[model samples]
Target: MKRRNLLIAVILLGAAVIFYRAFGTPDQLATGAAMVNVTVPELSETANEGEAAFNRLCASCHGRNAAGQDGVAPPLIHKIYEPGHHGDASFLLAARNGVRAHHWPFGNMPPVEGITDPEIAEIVVYVRELQRANGIY
Candidate 1:
Protein backbone atom coordinates (compact mmCIF):
# COMPACT_ATOMS: atom_id res chain seq x y z
CA MET A 1 0.00 0.00 0.00
CA LYS A 2 2.83 2.42 0.82
CA ARG A 3 4.57 1.73 -2.48
CA ARG A 4 1.32 2.17 -4.38
CA ASN A 5 0.66 5.53 -2.73
CA LEU A 6 4.21 6.70 -3.51
CA LEU A 7 3.80 5.71 -7.14
CA ILE A 8 0.49 7.59 -7.38
CA ALA A 9 2.09 10.70 -5.83
CA VAL A 10 4.97 10.53 -8.29
CA ILE A 11 2.55 10.24 -11.21
CA LEU A 12 0.57 13.22 -9.95
CA LEU A 13 3.75 15.23 -9.54
CA GLY A 14 4.81 14.36 -13.05
CA ALA A 15 1.44 15.43 -14.38
CA ALA A 16 1.72 18.71 -12.51
CA VAL A 17 5.16 19.31 -13.96
CA ILE A 18 3.88 18.66 -17.44
CA PHE A 19 0.97 20.98 -16.88
CA TYR A 20 3.21 23.78 -15.64
CA ARG A 21 5.59 23.37 -18.53
CA ALA A 22 2.72 23.53 -20.98
CA PHE A 23 0.78 26.33 -19.37
CA GLY A 24 3.61 28.25 -17.68
CA THR A 25 4.04 29.56 -14.10
CA PRO A 26 2.11 32.32 -12.30
CA ASP A 27 4.80 34.86 -13.17
CA GLN A 28 4.61 33.89 -16.83
CA LEU A 29 0.85 34.10 -16.62
CA ALA A 30 1.13 37.60 -15.24
CA THR A 31 3.54 38.58 -17.99
CA GLY A 32 1.08 37.28 -20.58
CA ALA A 33 -1.72 39.22 -18.91
CA ALA A 34 0.36 42.37 -19.10
CA MET A 35 1.16 41.61 -22.71
CA VAL A 36 -2.50 41.14 -23.44
CA ASN A 37 -3.06 44.73 -22.34
CA VAL A 38 -0.32 46.05 -24.58
CA THR A 39 -1.66 48.31 -27.35
CA VAL A 40 -0.61 47.55 -30.90
CA PRO A 41 -0.29 50.08 -33.71
CA GLU A 42 -2.87 50.30 -36.44
CA LEU A 43 -2.55 48.88 -39.93
CA SER A 44 -1.68 51.12 -42.93
CA GLU A 45 -4.58 51.00 -45.38
CA THR A 46 -7.28 52.60 -43.24
CA ALA A 47 -5.15 55.41 -41.85
CA ASN A 48 -6.42 58.09 -44.20
CA GLU A 49 -10.08 57.23 -43.85
CA GLY A 50 -9.61 57.08 -40.11
CA GLU A 51 -8.30 60.62 -40.05
CA ALA A 52 -11.32 61.79 -42.03
CA ALA A 53 -13.75 59.95 -39.77
CA PHE A 54 -12.05 61.31 -36.69
CA ASN A 55 -12.39 64.81 -38.05
CA ARG A 56 -16.06 64.17 -38.64
CA LEU A 57 -16.96 62.46 -35.36
CA CYS A 58 -14.39 62.85 -32.62
CA ALA A 59 -12.85 66.23 -33.46
CA SER A 60 -15.34 68.44 -31.64
CA CYS A 61 -14.17 67.41 -28.19
CA HIS A 62 -10.88 65.66 -28.90
CA GLY A 63 -9.97 68.52 -31.22
CA ARG A 64 -8.94 68.71 -34.89
CA ASN A 65 -5.39 68.33 -33.55
CA ALA A 66 -6.22 65.74 -30.88
CA ALA A 67 -4.64 68.11 -28.34
CA GLY A 68 -7.55 68.18 -25.90
CA GLN A 69 -10.44 70.55 -25.25
CA ASP A 70 -9.14 72.61 -22.31
CA GLY A 71 -12.20 71.95 -20.12
CA VAL A 72 -14.09 69.42 -22.19
CA ALA A 73 -11.72 66.53 -22.97
CA PRO A 74 -8.18 65.20 -22.74
CA PRO A 75 -5.57 65.02 -25.46
CA LEU A 76 -5.53 61.85 -27.54
CA ILE A 77 -1.96 62.42 -28.62
CA HIS A 78 1.47 61.26 -27.41
CA LYS A 79 1.56 59.46 -24.08
CA ILE A 80 -2.21 59.32 -23.73
CA TYR A 81 -2.18 57.45 -27.06
CA GLU A 82 0.38 55.08 -25.66
CA PRO A 83 -0.15 51.37 -25.05
CA GLY A 84 -2.72 51.26 -22.29
CA HIS A 85 -5.06 54.01 -23.41
CA HIS A 86 -4.53 54.36 -27.13
CA GLY A 87 -3.50 50.98 -28.39
CA ASP A 88 -5.34 49.63 -31.43
CA ALA A 89 -7.23 46.96 -29.51
CA SER A 90 -7.98 49.42 -26.77
CA PHE A 91 -9.24 51.86 -29.36
CA LEU A 92 -11.46 49.21 -30.89
CA LEU A 93 -12.83 48.25 -27.51
CA ALA A 94 -13.46 51.87 -26.60
CA ALA A 95 -15.17 52.56 -29.91
CA ARG A 96 -17.19 49.38 -29.89
CA ASN A 97 -18.08 49.19 -26.21
CA GLY A 98 -17.26 52.71 -25.04
CA VAL A 99 -14.82 53.57 -22.25
CA ARG A 100 -14.92 55.63 -19.08
CA ALA A 101 -11.25 56.04 -18.24
CA HIS A 102 -10.75 52.57 -16.82
CA HIS A 103 -7.00 53.29 -16.86
CA TRP A 104 -6.91 57.05 -16.40
CA PRO A 105 -8.44 59.68 -14.14
CA PHE A 106 -8.53 62.62 -16.53
CA GLY A 107 -12.27 62.19 -17.02
CA ASN A 108 -14.81 59.70 -18.30
CA MET A 109 -15.08 59.45 -22.09
CA PRO A 110 -18.65 59.07 -23.10
CA PRO A 111 -19.70 56.17 -25.32
CA VAL A 112 -20.05 56.70 -29.09
CA GLU A 113 -23.12 54.60 -29.71
CA GLY A 114 -24.47 55.74 -33.05
CA ILE A 115 -21.32 54.92 -34.96
CA THR A 116 -20.84 51.57 -36.70
CA ASP A 117 -17.91 49.13 -36.62
CA PRO A 118 -16.48 50.13 -39.99
CA GLU A 119 -16.55 53.73 -38.85
CA ILE A 120 -14.71 52.74 -35.67
CA ALA A 121 -12.10 50.96 -37.74
CA GLU A 122 -11.61 54.11 -39.76
CA ILE A 123 -11.29 56.12 -36.57
CA VAL A 124 -8.63 53.71 -35.41
CA VAL A 125 -6.74 54.35 -38.60
CA TYR A 126 -6.94 58.10 -38.19
CA VAL A 127 -5.78 57.83 -34.60
CA ARG A 128 -2.78 55.82 -35.68
CA GLU A 129 -1.97 58.38 -38.32
CA LEU A 130 -2.36 61.21 -35.85
CA GLN A 131 -0.04 59.50 -33.40
CA ARG A 132 2.56 58.93 -36.10
CA ALA A 133 2.26 62.52 -37.28
CA ASN A 134 2.71 63.63 -33.68
CA GLY A 135 5.82 61.40 -33.58
CA ILE A 136 4.51 59.24 -30.80
CA TYR A 137 5.91 56.20 -32.68
Candidate 2:
Protein backbone atom coordinates (compact mmCIF):
# COMPACT_ATOMS: atom_id res chain seq x y z
CA MET A 1 0.00 0.00 0.00
CA LYS A 2 2.87 2.43 0.80
CA ARG A 3 4.51 1.67 -2.54
CA ARG A 4 1.22 2.26 -4.37
CA ASN A 5 0.78 5.59 -2.59
CA LEU A 6 4.33 6.62 -3.52
CA LEU A 7 3.59 5.78 -7.17
CA ILE A 8 0.42 7.85 -7.03
CA ALA A 9 2.37 10.78 -5.55
CA VAL A 10 4.89 10.61 -8.40
CA ILE A 11 2.12 10.61 -10.97
CA LEU A 12 0.50 13.62 -9.32
CA LEU A 13 3.85 15.44 -9.33
CA GLY A 14 4.28 14.67 -13.01
CA ALA A 15 0.81 15.99 -13.75
CA ALA A 16 1.60 19.17 -11.81
CA VAL A 17 4.74 19.72 -13.85
CA ILE A 18 2.82 19.28 -17.08
CA PHE A 19 0.14 21.70 -15.92
CA TYR A 20 2.71 24.32 -14.95
CA ARG A 21 4.47 23.97 -18.28
CA ALA A 22 1.25 24.32 -20.21
CA PHE A 23 -0.32 27.13 -18.18
CA GLY A 24 2.76 28.78 -16.71
CA THR A 25 3.82 29.00 -13.06
CA PRO A 26 2.00 31.10 -10.47
CA ASP A 27 4.21 34.17 -10.94
CA GLN A 28 3.75 34.07 -14.70
CA LEU A 29 -0.03 33.88 -14.18
CA ALA A 30 -0.11 37.07 -12.14
CA THR A 31 -1.37 39.73 -14.58
CA GLY A 32 -2.79 42.19 -12.07
CA ALA A 33 0.57 43.15 -10.63
CA ALA A 34 1.67 46.78 -10.70
CA MET A 35 3.30 48.00 -13.92
CA VAL A 36 6.93 46.98 -14.16
CA ASN A 37 9.40 49.77 -13.61
CA VAL A 38 11.30 50.87 -16.72
CA THR A 39 14.23 53.21 -16.63
CA VAL A 40 13.99 56.06 -19.19
CA PRO A 41 17.22 57.81 -20.06
CA GLU A 42 17.55 61.55 -19.62
CA LEU A 43 17.35 63.69 -22.77
CA SER A 44 18.75 66.89 -24.15
CA GLU A 45 16.62 70.03 -23.89
CA THR A 46 15.06 69.52 -27.33
CA ALA A 47 14.58 65.83 -26.79
CA ASN A 48 13.17 66.56 -23.32
CA GLU A 49 10.53 68.76 -24.88
CA GLY A 50 9.84 66.01 -27.34
CA GLU A 51 9.49 63.58 -24.44
CA ALA A 52 6.84 65.81 -22.93
CA ALA A 53 5.07 65.94 -26.25
CA PHE A 54 5.25 62.17 -26.56
CA ASN A 55 3.88 61.71 -23.05
CA ARG A 56 0.99 64.00 -23.88
CA LEU A 57 0.28 62.89 -27.44
CA CYS A 58 1.68 59.39 -27.81
CA ALA A 59 2.09 57.63 -24.46
CA SER A 60 -1.54 56.54 -24.32
CA CYS A 61 -0.87 53.91 -26.98
CA HIS A 62 2.92 53.88 -27.41
CA GLY A 63 3.58 53.72 -23.66
CA ARG A 64 6.04 55.91 -21.78
CA ASN A 65 9.33 56.36 -23.67
CA ALA A 66 7.71 54.49 -26.55
CA ALA A 67 8.42 51.16 -24.83
CA GLY A 68 5.03 50.15 -26.22
CA GLN A 69 1.80 48.90 -24.69
CA ASP A 70 0.57 45.40 -25.33
CA GLY A 71 -2.46 45.26 -27.62
CA VAL A 72 -2.15 49.00 -28.08
CA ALA A 73 0.99 49.81 -30.06
CA PRO A 74 4.36 48.42 -31.12
CA PRO A 75 7.51 49.60 -29.37
CA LEU A 76 9.68 52.19 -31.09
CA ILE A 77 12.77 50.92 -29.33
CA HIS A 78 12.63 47.55 -31.05
CA LYS A 79 15.10 46.44 -33.71
CA ILE A 80 12.39 46.36 -36.35
CA TYR A 81 12.29 50.15 -36.16
CA GLU A 82 15.98 50.65 -36.83
CA PRO A 83 16.59 53.75 -38.95
CA GLY A 84 17.48 51.59 -41.90
CA HIS A 85 14.12 49.88 -41.84
CA HIS A 86 11.90 52.69 -40.59
CA GLY A 87 13.56 55.97 -41.33
CA ASP A 88 12.68 59.27 -39.65
CA ALA A 89 10.28 60.03 -42.50
CA SER A 90 8.25 56.98 -41.67
CA PHE A 91 7.34 58.42 -38.31
CA LEU A 92 6.30 61.69 -39.87
CA LEU A 93 4.19 59.91 -42.45
CA ALA A 94 2.65 57.66 -39.84
CA ALA A 95 1.63 60.64 -37.72
CA ARG A 96 0.33 62.54 -40.73
CA ASN A 97 -1.38 59.59 -42.34
CA GLY A 98 -2.59 56.58 -40.44
CA VAL A 99 -0.64 53.39 -41.10
CA ARG A 100 -2.20 50.10 -42.05
CA ALA A 101 -1.82 47.22 -39.62
CA HIS A 102 0.97 45.00 -40.74
CA HIS A 103 3.60 44.04 -38.18
CA TRP A 104 1.68 43.92 -34.92
CA PRO A 105 -1.72 42.74 -33.75
CA PHE A 106 -2.63 46.23 -32.54
CA GLY A 107 -4.87 47.53 -35.33
CA ASN A 108 -3.99 50.36 -37.71
CA MET A 109 -2.55 53.58 -36.34
CA PRO A 110 -4.73 56.64 -36.83
CA PRO A 111 -3.25 59.91 -37.95
CA VAL A 112 -2.36 62.02 -34.95
CA GLU A 113 -4.42 65.19 -34.53
CA GLY A 114 -3.58 68.52 -32.93
CA ILE A 115 0.15 68.23 -33.74
CA THR A 116 2.11 69.86 -36.50
CA ASP A 117 5.15 68.92 -38.56
CA PRO A 118 7.53 70.73 -36.21
CA GLU A 119 6.04 68.92 -33.24
CA ILE A 120 6.36 65.65 -35.08
CA ALA A 121 10.00 66.43 -35.69
CA GLU A 122 10.45 66.97 -31.98
CA ILE A 123 8.74 63.67 -31.23
CA VAL A 124 11.01 61.95 -33.72
CA VAL A 125 14.04 63.40 -32.00
CA TYR A 126 12.78 62.16 -28.66
CA VAL A 127 12.00 58.69 -29.96
CA ARG A 128 15.33 58.34 -31.77
CA GLU A 129 17.22 59.54 -28.70
CA LEU A 130 15.41 57.02 -26.51
CA GLN A 131 16.06 54.32 -29.07
CA ARG A 132 19.74 55.20 -29.15
CA ALA A 133 19.96 55.15 -25.38
CA ASN A 134 18.35 51.72 -25.27
CA GLY A 135 20.77 50.40 -27.97
CA ILE A 136 18.06 50.06 -30.56
CA TYR A 137 20.00 52.24 -32.96
RMSD of each: 12.7, 8.6
- Cα shift from native, residue 14, model 2 (Å): 36
Provide the lowest-lDDT 10-residue window in model 2.
29-38
Residue-wise lDDT of candidate 1 within 1-137, one digit each (tens)? 99999999999999999998666666543221111112335536686677677777777767655665544555677676765655678777776676776544335777776777788878876666666665666
Tens-digit lDDT string for candidate 2 (88-135): 999999999989988775679999988788888999999888778777
Q: 96, model 1: CA deviation in Å?
A: 2.4
TM-score of 1: 0.57
lDDT of 1: 0.65
Please give the range of 10 consecutive residues that has the lowest summed lDDT in model 1: 30-39
Give the candidate number with the greatest TM-score.
2
Per-residue error (Å), model 1, residue 51? 2.0
